[model samples]
Target: MLLRDRVALITGGTSGIGLSTAELFLREGARVAIVGRSEDKGKRALERLEVLGEVTFHRGDVSKEEDSERIVKEVVSRYGRIDILVNAAGVFTGAPLIEMSVEDWDRTIAVNLRGTFLMTKFSLPHMGEAIVNVSSTAGVSPYPNGTAYCSAKAAVIAFSKALALELAGRGIRVNVVAPGLTDTPMLRGIAGSEERMREFASLVPLGRIATPEEVAEAILFLASPKARYVTGQVLVVDGGMTAGRVTTAGSRAAVR
Candidate 1:
């Protein structure tokens, strides 16, 4: 059990990568608390997790400072201390730069970027351990009409790196896991059509999309003692998408 007796708090844990990570942590001998915005979803996740180990669910918007602070307090009050913090709560919105409104940009940044900051801020005092910030390949590569989402994710990468340096002296490690095109409910929602989803999956070098569990596995490695010396790093689990190249006529372009 790599995480034996550890306590983890995961934001946006009702579904997707967050839920999978919570489940994996519990199986590895960790107690977990998951936060979601919907009570029904939170309760369902809590019920499912309870079958594995000690699990608590808090329903709240991670973008709110009070909710973030309250969740940290609630977890510490119940679990004594927090060994891991996973800021997996995020939103994805796509629109052409010229069409994207201020509200859209603000909302995207608020939940994906600000939420991560607030959660880390509140969890730091209780976290003498590890923190994993979930980023996206969009942070490293440009996607069409993903201005707000891309910028927010890129900010997470930068924020986690800075945080890692700031907390190194305290024995606290911070790292970012940038997942590629994962087949989460969130991604499915953005698909809107089956054809669109298939097209997106076809672009991956694996000829398929990643499961939430795959991404969670990378996150677990970063959070566990196995990565004790790993900090200020961005681990990209993109199924080789960013490594693919393009050939046109007698010319070729290589991608890194």
Candidate 2:
């Protein structure tokens, strides 16, 4: 119940990591506002979240300035203040730089990078404590054929660190969580089938993609007061993929 009595606002709250975080926040006692662009998804997510605790749906496009302002205003109008803000709304496109369209690249940057800035910018005035942004392992490590995603996500990490400094004096902490291959609709759509899923899993040191809940847990920790002294940090939750390449050194014991 770390968030007991707190007010939380989650972008991309309709699915994947965002939705999981919303549910966890509710269970921990926060009144949450779930923001999404899809009306149907928002309604469905709201219905499910309502059963857990106090929740509301704020439909908007985070990449748009107007929507960002309106979303923050609506959430405040409903709940008065925001204790935790999670910018989890994101999109991905798979194509090599040479093959990628200009529109695709712009959209990726808009949603993953600009969206974060807009949300945090408008919400800063009404914030009570912290903000946890969702980046990707690709942000730290690169993703093949995913130039746009990698670039945007990497920018998110840098932007968050800079924001953390700007907001530290205000008692509002900003941090980032970079997840590796997580089991989500976004990844599933790319994998396409179970065989491809297995192929995807084979690359991870952990041998499997993480669940949305696992990523959500890291987000919760950063958003909670337990991390009060921590700020301007990026917590990488990608198992050991970014740790380094797998080695056979463990198999051979040294003569000691």
State every prediction's TM-score relative to the real structure. 0.95, 0.96
**What would the per-residue lDDT of candidate 2 be over residues 57-82, giving only the tens digit for each residue?**
99999999999999999989989988
RMSD from true fold, candidate 1: 2.7
Clash count per candidate: 0, 0
Which candidate wins on TM-score?
2
Q: What lDDT score goes with residue 103 in model 1? A: 94
> Against the unseen true structure, what C-alpha lDDT does each candidate score?
0.91, 0.92
Poorest stretch of ten by lDDT in candidate 2? 247-256
Cα RMSD for candidates in order: 2.7, 2.1
Worst 10 residues of 1 by lDDT: 247-256
